[model samples]
Target chain A: MRRLRSAISTASAEFQRHYAHNRRLAEELRERQERARHARPQRDLDRLERQGKMLPRQRVERLLDPGTPFLEFSSLAANMAYDGESPGASCITGIGIVSGREVVIHADDSSVKGGAWYPLTIKKIVRCLDIAIENRLPVVHLCDSAGGFLQLQSEVFPDRYMGGRIFRNQCILSKLGVKQLALVFGHCTAGGAYIPGLSDYNVIVQGTGAVFLGGPPLVKAATGEEVTVEELGGAAMHTSVSGTCDYPAGSEEEAIAIGREIVAQWDRPRKWDCQREEPEEPYYDPDELYGVLPDDIKKQFEMREIIARLVDGSRFHEYQPNYGTTLVCGFANLWGWKVGILANNGVLFNDSSLKGAHFMELCNQNNTPLVFLQNITGFMVGRAYERAGITKDGAKMIMAQTCSRVPKFTVMCNGSFGAGNYGMCGRAFDGRLLFTWPNHQIGVMGGDQAANTLAEVKLKQMQRNGEAVDQAVIERLRDETRAAYLEQLSAWYSTSEIWDDGIIDPVDTRNALGMAITASLNAPLGESGYGIFRF
Target chain B: MALALLLGAEAAGIEIVRRRPHLVVRIDGREHEVVERDEADGRTRIELDGRPLALACAADGNTRFLRLGGRNLRVSLVDPRDAAAAGEGGGDEIRAPMPGSVVTLHKAEGEAVLRGETILTIESMKLQTALVSPRDGVVELLLRGEGQTFDKDEVVVRLASPSAPGPSEPAPPEPATAEASPAADAKGAA
Candidate 1:
């Protein structure tokens, strides 16, 4: 592979403008992430400190290997929900190295509402477990929660993928021979108790950590027998009397130490062999990515420039470079792991779709993981494109991508709209991990297009009813629709709703994908075969 | 083949004669023994033909800057392949690489432009590509205006002949062959 030639002029006015704009976005992202991770009400912090407990992040840091990176799932999981009450969905989940073994950690943020489980919190936890199951990674559960938020019980409890799915995933993970360890740091009442109950091994802190089907008040109300929490399910009762928990610890720190030792005893996953080489730093500065990305979402920039800054040694071997000009399919090493990258330079044309489908097939056959860098608007839409079988070609691409046995990862670099999302491994495609940049937007169509489409429908409806089509009303409607669409299309909303795993800083993309790909290798490749090709 | 190293206005040819107990190099047909050592103070000591010289060196891409004897000097390595490729000058007419419409015109006719300055921007297949000047010259004509469409291989801009007088100068045209040779020589020198 040869180093990609960069044509960017860092001293140009455009570069300066984009650098300033993107730097501001990145700074804002850092600020929000910092606040979400650490900021808490004084009362909550005081309560935890009084109870002799560590902050959720502190617990996670201590549980992880000293200096290993933790790829946190969603720091702003419920930033837009619960009336700004639940930061990080009142929980923390990420992939981290525990006792020299790769494990997914789910720590309950006890600093918020006694670490209650909101609707999105359950979704986030379930998503993490799902990742664990898919990648065959072990799980370390930091058990602490006030059960489900009762006010939003309808949304959090009854649905198929709500609270119940978390336990179901836990059961499946255990049944699949994947290891799970629970370190009880606080109350795990009702359904939360099942987290520790179902784990392969569990440890409970003496004074603060407790697991119970119902806490003291609930026990009093249901059975009319008033019992203390320690007697009901504390470390001494569960570990000694009930035999529900495996180990007892004097404090949270001791529990973490016990948990680390337990994790060390688990067998290491036998990762399937894949093409790997000595990792190389990208020749181009990854910081230049701020200038490479455009300020405006509609503007176009070369995807090769992004790939050059992301891949090893800034090297790429482009596949079908001339045949499909819009979709750049290539082979590059991401953190020494050989991966096939499909990046969208423009709307998908027939040839581009065909090229992508072929490239995906090649990657699967060669046991290489697939990485999709999506900036797609949509496939070409016109009489000419329709006649050219663009729909069939797109189907071929989607089919190939969906059936890919190789681990797939996606980065929402910019726009993701319409069916282009499907062909490029959108959230529904079961990508091993999907991350979004702060500037990313995802919707069925762009805000302006959706607004115009709605306005046109209204105009036709008014004409059919023989009513006056007020221009002011139409304009107002258009503006309102566009505003609403823009809000929903934003990366914050997508992440808050758990549409993606999380929003990542653009420069951290390489590291995030590296960790994801490494975790994905724990599982062998899936059975490979496509249902059918439209071609 | 000896590699070319450019130091200010002078060019030197250097080839490695042998790599053994000490490095041996032939510079401009003279064999010289060279050895390098790093001092504790982060400065490099170079023994060129057994004459010790201490310098601090910093490198950026293919160019190296040295601070020696209270003076700063820059030395750049020029790849023979790149020099050979740069020697082939572009044609007088700039043709479209693909069927596209001009989106922006950065340069106008009779304007002096640098070798790599953007002449215009064209949009095709939902991508915009910038067309840059092939060489330092005066633009004689812009065949397409903004928003005007053109076919592939069609001439989009034409440069004034090297021998012809520039529009701004209004001077008499020189003999074509007699002026072209010196212009080529000047480009090579640059």
Candidate 2:
């Protein structure tokens, strides 16, 4: 009996101690939960807005560190009409911070009238592009749209392209150094496809979202192809072929997470890309190309073959397959260096001078290499010039080149004359090296020159009275004199020599250019950067 | 395959009256000889005053190859500083070259714009990448907003711009011994 009482008392004491400890632990847990709940809770509206379910104001939360000091620009931006009217506006863009990186974004929500881009959207985007280029910012785009504005097309009306004035901002971005990327969610098609297409990197939600150049209806009408929108322009289609999107995701959350992840891929201003798994040997040796071209100036040549032979064959890209025909410009891999290259075409005259200038400009902008092959005669002169508006159109080329700061090289294949020589970076131009085939002959005059010279000599000798053979000699000498004048002009040391950095054997031209470029790269800075001599 | 060769008379100093991008030559060595070519189509063209000679050859003349005159030729023109933007793959903006209705702003204005981001959704060729922003910049301005239209690569946004202005400085020298390429960065961040 005594032992049982003692055991009961001990057990009661143990229970009291256990109850007090449990109560204290539970109290602490509740307090921590309360604090966490109040600390920067994710706003429901913000989540809904991103899901294409709310307005911009509703989606925007404190984008900076909660309760930390930060300045807000254009804090009250909204689509409130002049008369306080509520309308369909799809994009919401403004300055804010996510983890301290100051950035602006143009977000389109598909739930809002299919997220169309109208005149206002164009202006808004242009403004964003211009500002980014001018400031060299790291741009981010949060995209979710069906495509263009079908309903609001009539709201902002203009005679020419409906307010396209701000469209040039893209070039400005390219000219300057800036970083851009696209994130896709929901249905993206047609115009929406480009958002990720032209970016440095693209991320897309695999199953929940898709991107295409045209939606199914348009596709069916245009090409009689009645496939689903996603089937035609899905994440896989974009990332694998067409060289459009770079990254593909499985879900919206994954896409956004990838967006945040990609944004931090490079340091603040510097840019970057992923290296693809490729073969060991390059496409071909640039040196083995001595016999790939025909000596005929009028013959056609495969430009891509040459590029493949010169660079890593498997790692080059060409843009605008149908735009310019006179010249070629794109990015390529040389040795291990990533670079931009501009080449002149041998058979197309889409815009010779204009193409040349563009090459120069691209070289300067991207610090790439510029190469030219001398294959010319004269532009279709006179009436043809008027029809092509050569003067106005051609000048833009020079402007682009004149502003370039990249290295340049040229090879003289055949007959270059007048502006022709200039176009090929002649002694009077900016080629790092100039070389010509042994069988080359450049002159200002052709066929009639030789005939005239012989005629002039014969007539002069025929004069027995020693009287000067005036008119006959003059008329006969016309062609020959012109040829001789051209010859002398080309040979003048000042004309081609002092003006050139070097001249080499045609076969060794590529090596010589490579050497010169290595030596002059990022050399002394100056006004002579890309300026044309004697222009 | 039609070709022509041009040469300076007497091989003296070269002079010029004009320079165009492409040229064709007509040669005759056999009965009823003929050829057609588009050399300048895929190659870079230089308009320098030099000599060129056209030659005739067999019709089966290695169509897979490029023939210059009677000899075969190949020319390479790749740059040395390609990267994200000018690199194989990177994000870039495609803005409008001029204002127009969002007649077809296809891509989402914002998202993960890769090296070739196409935000404006422009239309040309009855087709378009039509407008793209050149460099990587965040969509800041977007004056047109969606469902509206505007002109050119305008200030859509102050994208990719360093959030806040850095020192009133300019582009720094390229980093030597690059620890990471753009591609690596993309993968690393992921």
Candidate 3:
């Protein structure tokens, strides 16, 4: 392997302009993340304080081993939903180190609506548990949510991947021999009680924690029997009498202590070996990534410049550097784990798509993980390319990528449109983890292209119907379509819909991938071999 | 295979011969006996042909720095592939690999430029690619100004011919050379 020589001139005027523009985007990202994590109404904070409870983030921090990074998923899961009522979908989910073991932490944000589960909240929790099941990571549930929000019960409860999926995933995880622990700090009414009940181990705070299929009010309404909250399902009764919960703690802090001890007792997962070396920081400064990214979404930059700032020692062993010229495929160490990277340098052509498919097969054969840095518009479209079999070539790449036995990770570095998304491991591809940058956009096509395409279709329809082909009306419709498309194409909307794990700053990509790769090693590689290639 | 190391402007090829009782090596076709020991104070003791020297060495990526007798020297490994690629001289002109219009002009004709310095940037298929100088030379011509479009394989800019009298001298008409050499056009294509 050799160091990739960066061609970027950081002192150029263009570099300065791009630097200022992207720096502002990064700053805005920081502000949004800060607001989602900590900003809450004064009343919510006061109520939690009054109840002698720790904030959700505080509990997560104390539960994790000190100084270890927590790769949070969907930090802005519902930022565009619920009229901004649910921040982080009113819960916190991330991969963190707990008692020297890698565990996924799902802590409910009690500060928001008493930690009520919104429609998107259930979606986020289900996605988190799905991640645990996929990676075979142990789970720690900080039980504090107010069950499902009844106002949106239709969306939260009825569907296949709704509230029921969370408990279903827990059962699957336990069946797979994955460990789980729940610490109850608040009332677990109705479906929420099953969270602790399904876990292998659980701890409950004596005074504030309680678990019951039906709360006191529900019990009163249904059975015509009056009962106090403690008598119904308190920590002492559940731990001593019913054996529903294993540990009883006098306070929230004590419950966390007991939870950590329980996690320490479980067997550590045997990580399947992948080629690893002593980790080293990238030779190029990651901060330069700001300038390397273009200000405009459509504008293209060298993918090698981005790769230099991401891989270990800024070194890459480029594979077939001169053959494809559009799709850059190579091997690099990300966080010391040897990974095969497929990054789009331009529109995928027949040769480039063939190269990508071949490289993916090689990675699987070598038992190396694959990382896709997607910044593609689409495959080249033309009569010449069609005759050359661009579609089948692209299908070959997608087929090889979809059936890859080694773990795959994807980072949406920029534009992902059309079938380019599929070839590059889109959300539907079962990538172990997928992250998007703040500037990323994903759609069937770009805003202008989509608008133009629809406008053309409408124009032909109007002609066929003998309607007035009014230019003014057509222009208005184009602009409206473009505006709507642009909004939904943003990274925020993608993350809000949980299309990606989360929108991350460009500089944190290495660390995010590092954590993802480490967690993925807990599970062995999938069965090898691929379906038939078009060629 | 010999490992190439660059010190200042010079390069040396070294290969190890043996490492049993004492280290034996060949440097530039000359063999030498050597021994190395690590000192307690973080310095390396080296004996070359029965002469001893002590130095503190540190490495950053491919580059190594040595502090010996209060003088600092830097040595770096020269990857053979890179050296071979650079040795195939084709830094005379910048050509358009694809049909695109210039977005920005970083350098004008008659200006001195270093190898890898951007002469202009062109946008094609929504991609902005910088066309850089192939080697250290003076710009002889800027065929495409900002916003000017050119066809594939068209010469975007030409550096002063190396055979010219001086760096400031403009390149003379050489249609034959441009037509005959395919490697010159492929330089910018990469």
Best by TM-score: 3
Per-residue lDDT of model 3, residues B1-190, tens digit only? 4678988568877888988899899986888998888888877888888788877788976888987656788888997687887787556778775566999998887887666556787776555666666666788889988999887559989888877755464434322111111112222212
Segments of candidate 3 deviating more than 4 angstroms: A457-472, B1-3, B13-32, B35-77, B88-190
Report how far residue A140 has shifted in candidate 2, in Å: 50
Candidate 3 local Cα displacement, residue B117, angstroms = 6.0
The DockQ-based CAPRI class assigned to model 3 is incorrect
After TM-score superposition, the amount by which residue B102's alpha carbon in candidate 2 deviates from its true location, in angstroms, is 46
Question: Model 3's lDDT to the true fold?
Answer: 0.87
| Docking quality (DockQ) of candidate 2 | 0.01
The fraction of reference A/B contacts recovered in model 3 reads: 0.13
Better of 2 and 3 by DockQ: 3
CA-lDDT, candidates in order: 0.86, 0.44, 0.87
Candidate 1 displacement at residue A458 in angstroms? 3.6
Most DockQ-accurate candidate: 3
Query: Per-residue alpha-carbon lDDT of model 1 for A1-535, expressed as tens digits?
Result: 7567675677778778888888888998899999888888999999888888888888999999999999999888998888889999999999999999999999988899988889899999999999999999999999888889998899889889999999999999989999999999888999999999999999999988889888899889898998998899989989888999999999888999999999999999999998998999999899988987878777666688789889999988888766666788889999999999999877788988999999999999999999999998888776767898999999999999999999999999988988999999999999999999998998988898889999999999999999998999899999999999999999999999999999999999999999999999999899979998976
What is the Å distance of residue A460 in model 2 from its true position?
A: 16
Best by lDDT: 3
TM-scores for all candidates: the values are 0.82, 0.30, 0.89
